[model samples]
Target: MKSKYNFQVQHEDGSVFDMYQMGIWVESFHIYSPNPDRTFLEFPGKHGSYLSASYMKNRKIKISFQVETGSEYELDQLKHSIYNIFYTDQEFIITRDLSPGNILYALQNEEYDFDNITGEDADFNLTLTMADPFVYGQERIGTLADDAGYIDYNGTAETKPAFSFDVLAPITHLDIVSDDGYMRIGDPYTVEETPFEPETIILNDNMNTLTGWGPASSVDGGTVAGQMSVLNSNDFIASDYGSGSAWHGPSVKKSLSQQLQDFKVECYFRQAAYVNPKDTGRVELYLLDINNNVIAKLAMADAWKNMPKNRAEVRLGDTSNNNYMVNTSGKTDTWWNDFQGVIRLERIGTKFFAYVANITRDSASKHFRTWFTGFDDLEGKFQGKVAQVQLHLGCYGTDSAPSQAFQRIKVSKLNQPVTNQVPYIALPGDKIDINFKKSEILINGEERKDLKDFGASFFSFKKGRNNLFILPEGRVSTTVTWREAFK
Candidate 1:
């Protein structure tokens, strides 16, 4: 609320003089200088003030107003004050305020530091969780047909030994609900046998909307467990070998614990058995924030809709697809080929920088660890809004009936940040005084202060440790980050 004026008078000769002046009744000051460029005013601290510069051609003098306090109304009043001052004196026909912008021009053109400041700089840092706990997919059982009286007994007792009737609903049509409202539906499942004869499953194709398997349930889909059970339209099969289809496809329901922040979503998949390379089933890795909003999705060439506006897809290792980096390794077109795709999402502020990488079989094979994807602009543009996270085993577009099967998923948080050490130059014998007001000084094993009641003095240590002492006051006190002074 207080205003003061400073005048730095520079005569024609290379000399300077300082003058202090107070604002007059109208809350304005008028300066008459023969040389407009040579005479200017300076302000203390950084005030939201402006200057308007004008030169009087008639009187060969320059007139400018020094504004100390300015708001919308104050600025208007100052403008009128300058205009009145100019019109009242015919000799000073031209009048204006030396605004900050105008003053900057003068400083740059005349090479003058009106503020006597040194460096002009601005800086900012991008903050994000470098490492999040490695989150893995949690497993639960699907629905079963073990309930009593649910089946229609069609066989009559007259037919020798009565046969048990299995007129129960198909597991494919199974719908399991958790106490927490997590729902999982079983869909027609696909089974692929590898050369090793291991049965690999393709999970979700219909309910691609979900992020994770919602909650855990028993294998029979009876009650809620620590995890969630998948629901489906088909009935659960106990044993089926020939058809290559063992389980019903489940409508994927997202589990809440699967939610995460900055993290890596990965999946391992192989081609379907007895299927051609072009017919190979695809798996997907997806990311969704707490709001159940889809952040991003990645899959093999044939498994996704071509979002020309946002994505590019190609056959694995096909250089012709150019979008696939040269480093991507795998048969350009092959089925049952095991490969791992990883999407590393680094949440920076309201935006995310993602790096997608596809790794092949050979560990020694060279490939680019990542490729650039367009940034995800957050809806609210608020940093750290992301909470829940999930990994997708299957994301639509699978030539096979169901989706691809996933092996394992995991998540982990990084370690704490270490205190950065700052080096300082010091002499063997010097009095180090810290502003903390603690009277303490010891240099080369010698006490610099007579009494140890030093609350604000610096600690004088031997030349080796190079450590700066700091005493924290309270919770609100900022952690000290400084180096000791040296000779």
Candidate 2:
């Protein structure tokens, strides 16, 4: 539209003209506010006038005035009508005065109809019966026995390695030990057939218990991280390593695959020095897939740093299958001690993130970074299947692989997450669209109709002012525009 327009001055507001004189031929009408009193109509004049407008404060329901028609009589009547229409609301209440472009100016105030609107005023509240993203009624997944595991973290040669697989409550702390000397804390070590104490591995809520099994009189200092639980006696693995100085563990599978689509996984680990960053010895957090051999391993050491936690890595699938790795390489300091790392895997897309932390009193060192690997890069590997997950104390090596202890190990599945959106203002005649797939939009005290296909057919604005609800669609909403009466 052209910036300039023509206009003709009609009778002033003080005149006695009973006719609806043309106050200003608005080339374009921009409703600053939908509420009649708080609204400011901006548009170019049909009679050679610029589209500039301004608001007049210090009045009861302050109105924005513009130069047009020069007819005070018509302007006063028009202004009065607009003010009356909004101030005496039939649907909405002009509870707050709004700036010209404030996005919320379009929504009706909560106090619109004192009789219709009950309950405390609230932000957006969505309810879904089919596939709600917010709240669900007691929908539990996975058996109790399928959610917990154990590992050994006690360092020593006199203790036996022990672990559990309870369903009542998932075990979050474990320690496996054995009679051995000199455990590598870094990578590149050969797997050895050593005497491991299968009975010494204990899963407990406290980490100090494992200190007693410390390597032949060494000062044992470690923390048992995460929540704790023990299901039943039959719910554990005795010695899955199976002969020849090996270790074995029963596995637990994640229940909600589709629902846990876009979520995160976190855990903590403390491996023995031999299994550290030197010999590539490390702990196995979880075994996601077994069909195509897609497992996630936490490497103790890589081509990076020399600390067990320094060379921390997340390798998906097996080395033979594309070796998809997300490394937190070279980020080690005092903060790496007793810290947590998170891996956020996106459900829809083949992508994930990793976060690391270093312990510091009541907090942690804020330094953290992540690396991403695409599906195409892992084509020969696997798509996105996470089946079996085991918290192997000493992951890479065999049962004869000297025992490694873990102070704490907890796993939690992220639930429906919330994201914020940019706000925009709606004006009179503006059309809007809202989507409510696994949710419903609640405006005031009622549910809004779904507008997925027909673009906003379920919404209409009153002549003065009104407010409505829009539900979360997991996507951006459609664009809305204002309509002029004459246009």
Candidate 3:
């Protein structure tokens, strides 16, 4: 009995053709072995081989077919069409009916030979070299399921047996914003540290526990050793006292008129001793507005049984009262005695957000706590004006003035958002419209100097995926067309 087979050929231009439908009879098809050649390395003295490897060489397939026509014209036309397909060097894919999904990628390896050529019929023999040795399936089969979902055998199909879903729209136009501008679309702020140096010092040590304020005072303040200005309140009497000792460092004021809109106050301080368990004696650091009104305050107790060691509690308020306590159980703490504390206050739009970190001694810790306090009337009043920031220490309740020494006090303006620039990707055949000029475009990571306008085709998507990035100046609009290619 003779076997029957159907052949399908796909050309390099993505056109499919059927040989049987073209009046060509497929006589016999020959497929060579698929296994790769193995190579082994052996030593003269050793009985076993040292190394062995397999290499995949090109595979070959041959086909013998017959063509019949009634006239010379029909025979010439059929022969010419078949020659146009098999005579070229371009690659093609071949599939047989017996092998439903298995397809081979191959190219013409030998010259076509036509035997028994007559005015009516002819026999042709051709050979193909496989570009890839293995015969691949029509579609790829992945073992792992995707995050979106996978085809479940238990689920019922609506129309077809395949699963399908829609993807998000691609990014088309991107805008690039400059960081130099006062107000950008995204966050343009960069954190900078400014060392603290007090211009003035005020000390009221009524109890005479400390001499006075300044470097000569019996307090440790500066980075080096010596008596730095100390805020000592010895006003404690035999009975009780209202406010014990009070110390205020020289105010570091910045004009609200400055281009910088946000500011942070960082101070490195060490408590003289732990707070007395009996009485509520606490150390307070104040951030004052232009009118000397306390906007934010950091209150620290020597130690709390429920709280972490060396942690300070933060409160947000205006001139009226220091109400909003952001973090009740303040997570900021320091293992070492000498440590830095930071308070960041940023004016974003109409509202204000504050971030405070008490213990900054450990390098591996992320102790900074944040709060989002609604719009401040004081900030609105002093908008684009001068604001005063002062560091103060006071002793509350019956506790004596705990020696609170501050050093490396700094006031710096903080940038708005964490980052000003972002990245975007572009796929193949995508039309990317950049709202910003070419100077602001960054393709992959390198800046494209030749880009002049948004119309430039600076990127082309590869067979799979392509990445494109841009820095927007203001509001940005983008669209993308995602095209997938398969071999």
List the global CA lDDT of all models.
0.27, 0.29, 0.44
Greater-lDDT candidate between 2 and 3: 3
- lDDT per residue for candidate 1 within 1-487, as digits (tens), equals 3223333333211123222222321224333232222334557786654455633221112212233433445544544443332232111111122321111001101111112112221111111110111111111111122321111112111000101112122122112121112112112233431112111112323322224455211111112112212234221111211121221222223433433444433333332322233332333333345554444444443332322111212211112321221123232332213334443444433444444444444422212233555444445432332233333222222333222344343332212222332111122222222122122232222223442232222322222322121111110111221222111
Identify the superior model by TM-score, candidate 1 or candidate 3: 3
Question: In candidate 2, what are the lDDT values of residues 205-244, reduced to their tens digit?
Answer: 2232322221111000111222122223211112332222
Q: Which model scores highest in lDDT? A: 3
Candidate 3 C-alpha lDDT tens digits along 1-487: 2237668888743567788788888998887876477888998998988558866678788888988889878888888898777755667878787876767777887777567577778998888897666555444322212221222221111111111111123222233212221111212222352222111122212332323222211111211111213233432111212232332222122223333345544444555343433232234455555555555655554444323244455555543554454444343343312334444444444455555554334332223232234446454543442254433443333344444544434455544323332222332322332212112333322223343333333232233222233333222233322212222
Better of 1 and 2 by TM-score: 2
**Model 1 regions more than 4 Å off:** 1-261, 267-280, 301-338, 362-370, 373-403, 412-487
For model 2 the TM-score comes to: 0.29
| Clash count in backbone of candidate 2 | 71
| lDDT agreement of model 2 with the native | 0.29
Q: How many backbone clashes does candidate 3 have?
A: 20
lDDT of 3 at 308: 28
Model 1 has a clash total of 76
